[model samples]
Target chain A: MTQTRLVEVRQNVLKHNDVLARELRIRFQKAGVFVASFVSSPGSGKTAFLEKTLTKLRSQYRITALVGDLATANDAARLARAEVPVKQIVTGTICHLEAQMVSDSLQDWDLNELDCLFIENVGNLVCPSSYDLGEALRVVLMSTTEGEDKPLKYPTIFNTADVAVITKMDLAEAVEFDLKAAHASIQAVRPAMQVFEVSSKTGEGMDKWLEFLQAKFVDGQV
Target chain B: MHELSIALSIVEMGIEESNKRGGAKVDAVHLKLGRLSGVVKDALLFSWEIACQGTTLESSRLEITEIPVVVHCENCKTDRTIAEINNFLCPVCNAPTPEVMQGRELEVTALEIIE
Candidate 1:
């Protein structure tokens, strides 16, 4: 029988992605662009919300986006209607957007020409939490129909995000959504997490969200 | 769903590490897994076998050391172990613990191998 030995391996499993993310962060910082990535469960209004954001902020900032999905570029097509540079990263079976994907997608683009860049991750709460795409802000969306216990059930997602947006608030009343309970649940998992309630259709409560981005672009740290 | 890819990454990392040490056969990998790491242990375990198949880490085991969630309470001025993962409030002052001191680790600490 061969004798066994202990190998000292003090490496993080996701160190490769983390290193790439740090490199991307430096590149984005040098280019003076503020990056924000959106994450949500399927059908949580991420596309609609991003569309509204793109349409609203297109002229103010030289905006561009890279949207990721498991299958089609349908969401990218939808976002293109906003009349900004929008590309789709078809991840196929990948559930989250890694730093390498972001790096590969930005190969031909001039990052300095843009003021802000957004990455819409593949609709997932769990896996996306583990990977960082070099985003200055990570936004998580939860629609009213998804229930108030969502933050409680998927606490890790809430913990990983910088802000949470309650989308489709126009249907809140129709869905009998308890706004108080939802806020309480978000607070329960992530205390003092900035939460926004907005309806992409009606554009209610969007001004504040837009204003928040404006502030970030101006005062955002590299 | 994404656990398979994560498992594959872990296997790849393990293989690279073991190969650096003169192509030793990996016996097991020790990991520091925190509760708030967002990785499902069962799903990861299920995917490990498939990810390791035909790889250098093929029969190797994954040893996970679970780390509990610890939060720093501003009001209490002490780090407290969160009793419930959902309710992130300080038990002493009922104040929201805004700081997470631990429970988000995902590190490969060590490996057992044979020459």
Candidate 2:
């Protein structure tokens, strides 16, 4: 006697969370909330930059942020002072933040209430490049002290990013930061990428940064 | 560090593939990992054994084939393999290449299972 066992199994590798992320993208699009995510190595001043950005844009637009860290809600607490609703996703030991986590955490908040949402991804340049967080834009951050070869060292992340922000420009001279080399490196990976140089401490280049946000959300409204 | 997550994905995919063939236990999974895929081979192999514990891919072996980065030079009109990741310019013309023909791939190509 011969017996046949019928089995039905069809699944995508990232099936479980990708579906939720897709739905979240739809929700964000419908509400006209432009989402932006930041990625960089640890201690690249991501939170500090976001704090300044959120503080400046809070009055102009309904802004909220979701920050991710391996542990602690420190960034969330710091950003809440800007008076915009903020949440932190503690990824435990995870190196990178996934899209599903963002969707799950923001389930309680009304998407229409906010004009823009920023997701500060877990600070890692390499791994975060592979995962899409359903954001309208992805910005890669790098500080002057981290050296100018960062973009070349990690081209994948630089290539995936829509924009590159050079942080801590106030200390550029102290660290002997090579702006030309840095720009060249980024251009090599992604030519014609929009690059922003700013220092959160001195508020240098904040105007351009703010204008960018306004244009992206308020004027463009895409 | 993210190898564990990748290993989990491999296990999940292997389990689903095995289940499709009448729930046979997977013996191994073949993966084509490119040299510039940004995935550390040893780290992934180490994480795979641990990630397979209490899973359908517990006995599965991970076979990896490393593919070299190949780039097409518009200036020279020739395809060449880059021996090092840091070298981004074409060897003959010294011009920067735009299109990378091969490498930088991470995928699960096939699975071996036994009934």
Candidate 3:
């Protein structure tokens, strides 16, 4: 009979992804580019928000985006209308974007020429929480129409996110979106988390969000 | 969902480690899964079975130890295990405990192998 022995491995299951992410972080820092990744559920207006951001920031700074989807390059086509370079990462059946995919898609581009690079993760609140994409900032977006209890329902995403953005604020009143309750929910899960309220369509509250990004970019430079 | 991919990774790791140990057959994989890790235990177990098929770890069992969320409560000046993920307030002082001390672990702590 064979003998069984227990060996202490003590290794993180996602160590491979984590190592790749670390290498990407170092590369981004050396190139002086601020990388921000966006995560949210489907139909949360991620594409619209990114389009608006790219359009507004392209004039002042060189910006680009890499959008991920399960099967379609539609988001890439939409973002291209912003007149900035865009790449689409079709994950096929994969629900979330991994660091290796990001690293692979970026082989052709020079990171030094870009001021900011946004990775719009495949619309998912759960799976994306576990993978780190070597981004300087991880922004979690929740549209006002999604309801106030989103943070409570998906606490892990909120906890891992560096900042939160409440999009589609222009329709807040129509949806009867409780702003106070939303703030309370976000605070309960992630205390002192910086939040921005903006409507990508009407451009309301966009200036403040842009200013915050500008501040972060400046900080990254130093 | 993403657990299948994660399970595949675990199996790959197990095979690699076993190969390094003179191709010993693995009996079980010991994992520490945290509450805030965002992976469902049932889903991961289901995926593990499928991921292990046709591999060296085909018959290996996955033993998971669920870890609870622990946060540092500033008001109490100690670590507290919060019961609910929605409410992150300290049960003792009712203060917001934003600093999490533990519960994000998705690590393979050990492996049971037969020589």
Candidate 4:
């Protein structure tokens, strides 16, 4: 009888991505650039939020953004209206932005000149959580129009995220969003998770969110 | 869309691993799949064949060993495997557990190959 051998190969499935992400994190840290990435479901207003954030924060510090999409440069164009440096990373068909893609996209760009960089991932909640883009903070956005049980339905994304953002609060009244229920759901997944409720349209809650971001600066952080 | 990308990584890993065996061919890839891991078993399995098309893992079996989600209860001072995916509370004292002790595995544990 022919015998087959079993080989032990204890390797991570996403090992390559993790290694690249760690390298990126180190590079960003050395340059003193606070990097933040946004992940959300489609039509959750990630672009609008970034647009508002860049506009408000631009005067205080140098900021640039990289927006990812499957096929269009629409988000990149929309964000560039803030008059800050903005680039579009057309993923073609990929649902998430991997660390390698971010690294490649930043080629020839000076990270040390910028105080902060933002990466708006392709609007996908599920796959993006699995791929870390070496951001200092990861923001998971959910719109008021969606059900409060969004966190429960996609616990992985909620669990992986560093912060939760309740977007489009200006429409909360019209949508009848249950704020209490939404908070409870988020807490159920990750207790005491930092949350920000904001409306890009009305500019509500932008100050507090910006304050949290500012606190993450190099001098303020350990 | 990312399932396809993840599938490509798996195939790439499988081929590289198979090459290390000195002409041995891999028949199965043993994986440790955790409940907290974001990858879906069905979706990965569906994309496996397509990703391995004409590659070394074309006919290989993806044997996934599912690991249960475990949490550390602060009150109970115990690490327990959670039965339900959404149950983030301790079964005994009903205290909320934010620390995940296990179940985020995404490793390729072993491979069954023939020389």
Candidate 5:
């Protein structure tokens, strides 16, 4: 029998994705566009929130979006109603969007023309936490109906996210959603994480979110 | 769920490493997995078999070393290993430790091969 020896092959499993993400970050920086990605579980109102955000910000900023889904281009069509550039990335069986997929989708577009770009990842709380999509900010959303313990359950995603948004506040009272508990949960996982509470249906608390986004865009410019 | 893809990447890396060493047969791959890496060890082990099928990495064992989450306690000026992932506070001082010193590691540290 041949002697077995241990060889040092120190390598990152996601190095390929990480390198692509770094390159995309440079590209975004050079183009002067602020990129933000949204991740949440299915039925967390991510699409509705993005639609409202796009519609409100379009007049002041040149914004576009890339929506990823396991199948169908329905979200792209829905977002196109905002009268801005929209693209759909059909990931098929992939649970999350990788940096390569995002880069491939932006090949035909002129990133310089846009002031901000929103990438709505597939509704997966688990897989998307591992892949970095080269976004300057990662916003993880959880609707009031989803329970206040979401952050506690998926601590990795909460820890990795830059900010959190509590959606569907209009139903908070009806659903008896404990806002205090939710805030505590978020803080437990990510200390001092900025959070925004909004209701897409009633447009409540949207002004603060929009203002925050604009401020972040201005910061990215510097 | 995403472990299959991760396993495929590992197999690809193993193949490249083996090729660099005159196509030596790999016996095992050593990996460092962190608690905050969001990868389940058992799921990756199951996916590794499927990923290695019909490849040079077939029949190779995957040895995983799980790393616990570590945080930097600013007040103490030292790193501390937190027992609970959900709570980022320093166990000794009970102060919030926002800066993560380690964890979130997913790397192939070594490979065992037949010479």
Candidate 6:
């Protein structure tokens, strides 16, 4: 019997996921189904916010959503109210959604039938930052009550996001939210990160957010 | 938190790569982790052993080397290591550089197997 010898291998640690993500990216591009994923801490109104946005956009475009949670189908139920197709991904114990999870979840759906897909990832700012889910856009949410230093504390998530959504802005005054400092915190980590302040409850700033989405999904460019 | 999933993928990839290389048993999977990869090296190391437990790569070792965050100072034209974790200021000239030349990488670069 020969003893196994150690070989020096210098490869990217995430090559496997990156390769799968690349394939998914190509697939999404070919089918013209733009995928936007949402990542944020728990209680950040991801489901409610998505519900409002999907309701507005469903008529104009073929939209669908896949929401991941640690246990319940609550988010799927909430988003389904928009009248667009919705699926729930129960991660069991996983904190975040990975590319494999997204790929596996989409196997039953007909990509060609959908114009855009939104994935509401499991609520966690840290775990989701490292995983690439083949999304065209990644929107990270931060509610007013969550604290202004959120961007500074969780720089990884902010750095990874394409846009930052400051949710529940309607409560900004009530909670004495410092909007300027919050924006500055985001800019500190991601200098040019696009920011949108909205209140799903009041429908405030939803129009502009919807318009931004339309520009990307409908017009297909900046 | 997501390290277990990442570790699982690494194990799966190692098995496949080993099988392709004449069914060699994987010994260890080497990884180069960049500073800005946003992955906790300790967490990954802890989860890797567990992730490999029932897989073909059960006995494989995960070797990780931390890579420093290197940025190209356009003004100074020198590749400088970032002193602070997220701040990308050039040490030599203190000029603000927007480009991220290195760090922020998470990829499986290689797999080691015994034939």
Model 4 lDDT at residue A171: 95
The best-first sequence of candidates by DockQ reads 5, 3, 1, 4, 6, 2
At residue A102, candidate 6 shows an lDDT of 90
Each model's RMSD to truth, in Å? 1.2, 3.8, 1.1, 1.5, 1.0, 3.0
lDDT of 1 by residue, A14-47 (tens): 8888999999999999999999999999999999
Error of 5 at A97 (Å): 0.3
Q: How does model 2 score on DockQ?
A: 0.26
TM-score of each: 0.97, 0.86, 0.98, 0.96, 0.98, 0.86
Question: lDDT by residue for model 5 over B1-115, one digit each (tens)?
Answer: 7999999999999999889988888899999999999899999999999998987788999999999999999999999999888998999998888898888999999999888
> What are the clashing pairs of model 1?
none
lDDT of 5 by residue, A1-222 (tens): 799899998999999999999999999999999999999999999999999999999999999999999999999998998888999999999999999999999999998898999999999999999999999999999999999999999999999999999999999999999999999999988998999999999999999999999999888741
B-chain TM-score, every candidate?
0.93, 0.91, 0.96, 0.92, 0.95, 0.89
Best by DockQ: 5
Candidate order by decreasing lDDT: 5, 3, 1, 4, 6, 2
Interface RMSD of 6: 3.1
lDDT of 4 by residue, A1-222 (tens): 557778888999899989999999988988888899999999999999999999999999999999999988899999999999999999887888889899999997898898899999999888888887889889999999987889989888888888999999999999999999999899888766899999999999999999898888845341
What 10-residue stretch in candidate 6 chain A is worst by lDDT? A2-11
What is the lDDT of every predicted structure here?
Answer: 0.91, 0.82, 0.94, 0.87, 0.94, 0.84
Instruction: Give the winner by TM-score: 3 or 4.
Output: 3
The reply for model 1, stretches above 4 Å from the true place, is: none
| Alpha-carbon runs more than 4 Å astray in model 6 | A1-6, A219-222, B12-29, B52-61, B73-78, B91-96, B107-115
User: Which of the CAPRI classes, incorrect, acceptable, medium or high, describes model 1?
Assistant: high
DockQ of each: 0.83, 0.26, 0.87, 0.76, 0.89, 0.45
How big is the RMSD of model 1?
A: 1.2
State in Å the error of residue A183, model 1: 0.3
Better by TM-score, candidate 4 or 2:
4
- The digit string of per-residue lDDT tens for model 3 on A2-115 reads 999999999999999999999999999999999999999999999999999999899998898999999989999999999999999999999999999999999999988888
Candidate 2 lDDT over residue span A1-222, tens digit each: 434233223333455556766777788889989999999999999999999999988877888999999999998999898888999999999888887789789889998887999999999988887677888889999999999999889887876788999999999999999999999888777656789999999999888987886788755454
> What lDDT is reached at residue A107 by model 2?
84
In the predicted model 4, the residue pairs found to clash are none
lDDT for B99 (candidate 4):
91
